[model samples]
Target: MELLQSADLYRRAADRIPGGVHSNTRARAPHPIYFERADGAFLYDADGNRYLDFVLGNGAIILGHGHPKVQAAVQAVLSQGLTTGSETRLGVEAAERLLQQVPTAEMVRFANSGTEAVMHALELARSATGRTRVAKAEGAYHGWDSAMYVSAWPDLAKAGSADAPAPVLTHQGADAEISRRTLVLPFNDVAATRRLIEEHAQELAAVVVEPVMMDIGYIEATREYIDELRALTSRYGIVFIFDELLTGFRVAPGGAQEYYGVTPDLSTFGKAIANGYPVAAVAGRREFMEQARPGGPCAWVGTFNAHAVSMAAMCATLQTFEGGGVWRTLQERMSYLEERFAQRAAERGVQVTLRGRGGNFHWYFTDADVRDYRSAATSSAERYRKFAENAAARGIWLAAGTLSHHSLTIQHEEDHLDAFVGCL
Candidate 1:
């Protein structure tokens, strides 16, 4: 197969950077695309090719790329200085604003990335609970850190039984002793979760979960399931953390906690919060969050937390969403796009499964419904690879996976959705 100039750039990048990318998750066999820039819903490649950007910075661009409001905010901050290291006026304003927006949050702490935020949250949980064990869903990914990186992407054969999946270490030289502290459980199984939590309650510090499983094709928790988790965690006095890095601003202004009506003790926000800038935060009840500091036992220190530019970007992004009626617009566009995609797939005799909500959807080829990471893993990567290649050729961009995520913007119109349908 012939490769695009963008793909060639990725090959060159791989030779220098490990896997030709900073993150292994973005790398694939044919290589990734090298984008020159982006504006609105379009990405300009190094080859001067413009493609409709469904990836949307991997669901970070909720306000779309180069939003005028966000740009102006960043420019204003830049006119002064970009590095304030959590002491800037902008950082203060952003943190206060975030606390106002997040219902479960009485206090807020910032970090440079989702991974950093999650890592800190875990520490705070452990300190608050005085426990060492952390529990996560078998396939859910929190970050690259040793504690939470236990079973992100597991080999099917070595992953053990579906009922109680084995936690496989992804990193080299990772201490087996540390990995043993994390317990993996099947997602969406209330009974299984109850069993595990009950079994490990005394030793468990926290149970981290994504309200909407974003990377695994946006499978949502049934209200009953979430309620069960909350009750069980409350009973056990374990911190229930909602990793809303992908679902926070994208799902709703209040994030999944408000949408699901199940409030986690601690929540992490990222991706859409800064509309592509590298900013993340951990917010929760005042009592729990106070554990991370001079006021509490946990030492959650990061020099780069809430840098001036990122803080300005976050405040600006949230302000834009306040006026943009983002959730309503996303609902309308997603409903239309999903309907068209499903209709076209039906006509084409494609055996693909459509999952997720609003702008964030996953296209999968699976015989059974995907509820957790294991089921999501069995998705048809081969077909998605072909679909991505075809979509890229047709001037549409999508990630190659049995699941893909999207960001909604005004630039993505009916015509674009129709063209995507036509391609299918």
Candidate 2:
């Protein structure tokens, strides 16, 4: 696949834009592939290279790129005009749908991005509990906000002990006081988490966690860990926030809370909610979410909180999942891909471990059990990076850098699975 045109565009973009990309994740080692257009399960580059897109807009496009339903919804909004700066009937309808679908959603508020949703959730938690500290899993990424960004991708040297990890800030300008208020705990270590939570219970407002740790290659939380955390938070009067940005609609109709049978006090959702449209939400118990009201302690206001186009797309995406068969298909496809790839790796004498559930999985070129961030970090990322680059060269677009999660969409078929596994 020729990337000459993409390369030229990258050079031009670098002259004006930092690192030639808006998001740091888009900055490939050599150069990023500039896409001209996207269709169902495929991305067409500026150089006219047609590649099967596993990135799927970083797992945002659940129904796949340019789905007719989502496109029609967006078109309808366009024809009606992009209404913002105020609430619309469309937004109300979308919230009602979310409340109906999400198991923990009694009251809902919209945001333009997952980060903002998480921020709002944190603020509500702090307000409700009158606490100053928050705790999150060491490798779990809620968002890039200063309060939750610490220890997301901490360097091993500075990460401190596994049981009591230090909060290592990712960015330079992140507030030190916010980092100080944030406590880092190991994922899947129930005892350690309990001890930490108990130690800081008086000051801890919320304990935020991802049901499946996405930033650490989709390492799932054990049933015991999630259950204990839920019980402990309730017992201690601390808010339990589930960061479901990556797992919301992809895992189940109601998300991780439904999948795991444990509901959180508050939940932040995005990514698959709108099927690539920029929309996110904070939903939870009514009493907690009420903190965001005008007279409430926490302030929640946004100019484009529920942009009509995004609301339409979200409603359309929810409609597609009404039959409950969408998740089943995605699970079957992901399992098939996992099996085929494992077989291919065995044939080539390559050691690989596939971990995760639903439509998302990670390829770690090691047999070690990836239970936590440290174990996942120790895996052979160099080998996986090389594999991803080779796959991209051969028309499969896996996101570059780290052992990232690969996902399938409703549009993926057996042929795409065969092709992907065959590439390995």
Q: Which candidate's TM-score is highest?
A: 2
Q: Tell me the lDDT of model 2 at 283.
A: 94
Which stretches of candidate 2 lie above 4 Å from their native place? none
Clashing residue pairs in candidate 1 are 14-20
Worst 10 residues of 1 by lDDT: 401-410
What C-alpha lDDT, on a 0 to 100 scale, does residue 164 get in candidate 2? Answer: 94
Over 1-424, each residue of candidate 1 has an lDDT whose tens digit, in order, gives 2447867787678779988877655776667766778998888877788888888877888777999989999898889855764487888889988887786788899988888998899999889988988888877878866878888767778878777777888677667788867888878988877887898899989989887888777788778778988998899999999999888865666889888877899999988888899999999988789997685699977788888888989999887667538777777787887788889888899987666565787777778777788778777788777777788778888765555665566567788778766665
lDDT of 2 by residue, 54-107 (tens): 888878988889999989988988898757887788899899889888956789
Q: Which residue runs does candidate 1 get wrong by more than 4 Å? A: 1-15, 28-31
Q: TM-scores for all candidates?
A: 0.94, 0.98
Worst lDDT 10-window in candidate 2: 352-361
